[model samples]
Target: MSRPALPELSLLMVDDAVKAALLEDFGRAGDITSQATIPTDAKATGVIAARQAGVLAGIDLALSAFRQVDPSLDVSVLAQDGDKLEPGTIVARIYGPARSLLTAERVALNFLSHLSGVASATNAFQRKITHTNATVVCTRKTTPGLRSFEKYAVRCGGGMNHRFGLDDAILIKDNHIAVAGGVIPAIKSARAFAGHLVRIEVEVDTLEQLKDALTAKPDVVMLDNMGPELLKQAVKINKGQAVLEASGNVTLSTIQAIAEAGVDIISTGWITHSAPVLDLGLDIEIG
Candidate 1:
């Protein structure tokens, strides 16, 4: 089945990211190599092609990078984010000043390749547990400045987002539990300050801790590093008291086992932090 459309990323967000990247690349000199080799009036056509098979993402951001560099450039997006791609697929085509195309090439490919990698990795994890009730999720362990973009790519690959940030939800981790003295205390502390609308989740490393956490009646409990057998036990103990989240040591090889254990959500940092970059190249022809 074809994947559903991904939500539109904010234009303002894309523009800001592209502008920052271009500034870092251009600095004061601004594309010295292109300026020296390409004439001011020189024109070129370029095709952004995938060098390997993977899911496509960040087409808009890539186009924005080019437009931000030169508004006069003609850009045609041949594929949208969330589309599955094969090697040699033309993701986008650009025709404009050779200098402008050259200037934007690296930055555009950086966004496209990195976000597509995130989508592809997410898709890999999602595909592993398609028959189960569990859903794949992304964590905050994203690139320092690219959390929003990375999380968006997760959704493009048919995964759900956990929380956008700390303010969106109260996730009481092991550190918080220790600081507050225990799971119940941590839940209580969060409940005291957080509004009633906020859902509280706590991470527990043991079934004993899970039992203790369940008594607090938090909205969700994360089973950290638990094996499938332990996860099944936790699910049985939960008995619909709270949502179960499986995290830690999650990989493409082990994800299916974790999902089969009956957890409602599985979150991993690898998709955003360590995913391999999708190989894409901008092949240009100067005229």
Candidate 2:
């Protein structure tokens, strides 16, 4: 199936993040090495190209990095986010003062490579389950202070996002179940306290717990660490009662089977928290 049009990430959010990253990297003194080496008026042109094949993301943040350093820098985005990329693909071309380009290089590639990695990982998961009536999803386990950016990357790679934070959705986890006394009560408490629009999801480790939690009518149920056989059983028990989300121990190797087990969503942590950064680099043109 074709992916939906990618959603707009707020320019304000992108600006704020780029500004903070620039501040952190530019701390105390600016790029002293660039300042000392490159002539003040010298200009350079370069193409930020992929060093390996992967999906694309975070081009805007990379542009923001360049502009934050030198607004006069001319950048042409040859490829947009969500595009499939290959080694030597020219993602963007830049002509700007040499010093500023060098100064902004790390931060630009940091955003591009990292978010592209997330997108690529999510894409791998998507490809695994393309035949099934299931969607790959990302969880709250994201880089601190960069959740929105990473979640946007998940979208770029055609994955659905789970709750952004605790406030948006009431997820009664195992701990919440323990502290609240039991599965049914925890969901009940959340139901009582939650607004009409709020969705309540509860995590259950056993079939018994899943059956019990369903009684309280949670909006969704996360079947933690269940194998495909158990998941099939759980799906049978669910029988369209509530949305079933299969989570934990998910990897590229295991995702397709999990999807085939009939869970509505497969929530994975590694895609965002641990996906390797795609390799991309700036090749300065000679002449």
Candidate 3:
């Protein structure tokens, strides 16, 4: 079935990069295997089905990629972003020239599967927090050239996104701490040089450093690698003076306990960096 036109679509730079990569993969010619095996004008229809339960993401971009190959290719979305899907659920439908569909198959599935994986991981992390005002967030730990897409997927799965880049926000981490001699100097330099609108966050590993960070009065304090009890104590010390973010070695199993520690934000690197690709496949219907 032909899907209705998507009214408004925002294109991130990552989307453009993905489209470029797809074009590069296709080259002046298309998939030679599909071209050799399938007749040029043969028509086909298929469903992109999920193989496991997951929060759906990237179908819109996948649809866009398919259309880029052939405007005549029909795409119908059976599910939207953030929707939970069971195995065998048809997330999308495509009807078009068999050759074009086959040619675009890998690119389409690659983006869809990876993005859905990110969304699924974010959803799992969010599920861990039982009772807390803290929000789960994703870090700069994202796939190269795909950061925007991955962050978008994180949002789809109910997680917040940190600064998209160094330009957007000033985050002083441990390395910066060492380079500047300590958290105070790093915070001082960032605060002095940063524009009035810029917000600075400093990461600290110890309560003593937390004290130093507090003196600097940063916009946020990142509690790195602290256990649950220590995190709660850190929260108590902050006393709402600065926003609190917990990071380092976060996992789904430990997130709820972390959130309950009263931190304002939890950032995980694994959700985008190491999330397993969601299982998806395009099955063609022979008629």
Candidate 3 global CA lDDT score: 0.87
**CA RMSD of all predictions:** 1.3, 1.1, 3.8
Q: Model 1: per-residue lDDT, tens digit, 1-287? A: 65666788999999999899999999999999998998999999999999999999888889989999999999998998998899999998999999999999999999999999999999999999999999999999999889999999999888989998989999999998888999999998888988989999999999999999988889999999999999999999999899999999999999999999999999999999999999999998544
RMSD in Å for candidate 2, one decimal? 1.1
Find the 10 residues in a row with the least total lDDT in model 1. Answer: 1-10
Winner on TM-score between 2 and 3 is 2
Candidate scoring better on TM-score of 1 and 2: 2
- Show where candidate 2 strays beyond 4 Å: none
List candidate 3 segments past 4 Å from native: 1-9, 12-15
* lDDT at 195, model 3: 95
> For candidate 2, lDDT tens digit of each residue in 1-287?
67589989888999899889888999999899999999999999988999999999999999999998999999999999999999999999999899999899999999999999999999999999999999989999999999999999999998989999979999989888889999998988898999999999999999999999889999899999999999999999999999999999999889989999999999998999999999999989898
C-alpha lDDT of all candidate models, in order: 0.93, 0.94, 0.87
TM-score order of candidates, top first: 2, 1, 3
| Per-prediction TM-score | 0.97, 0.98, 0.93
